[model samples]
Target: MEKQKELVFITVIGQDRKGVVASISGYLYRKDVNIVDINQRIMTDGYFVMSMAVDAKAATVSMTEMSRELDQVGRELGMQVQIQHENVFRMMHRI
Candidate 1:
């Protein structure tokens, strides 16, 4: 039997810069959060946007803690980072 994976969608938006993916991916790796999917791009205005779906069931850190830490990371990168449960994300984006 397999436990259902807990997933969260993480989104980051801000000015384009170096190490954005590296830093976030590194942190998630260390926390045992598995990134299931990721999409990123630089808009015409030069702003960066990254969105990732992660399996967090095996994570050593709680979602609240991850959110706080990610918020700090976003501050350092001058970006806005947001995390939400997969179900919630789907609901919000649904037609």
Candidate 2:
């Protein structure tokens, strides 16, 4: 049987700054959350927004814990970050 991917969607929003992606990606990497897809851009006024799809099947922490930790990391980076299960995100974001 093929291994299933337990996916999570992560969103980050804040003023553009150095190391925003590095800090979050590093944290996830250390926790073994594999990033499946990433999209990020800076608005005309220098605000940054990012969305990522992560494979969390092998992560060391649960989704809730990961959210909390990501929040902390965002605070450290001076950003706002949120995470949700892929199903939940897809449901809410569906057109």
Q: lDDT of model 2 at residue 49?
A: 95
Model 2 sits at a Cα RMSD from the real structure of: 2.0
lDDT of 2: 0.89
**Candidate 2: clashing pairs of residues:** none
Best by TM-score: 1
TM-score of each: 0.88, 0.86
Q: How close is candidate 2 to the true structure, as a TM-score?
A: 0.86
TM-score quality measure for candidate 1: 0.88
Residue lDDT tens for model 2, 1-95:
75698788899999878888799999999999999999999888887999899999888998888989999999998889988778886678896
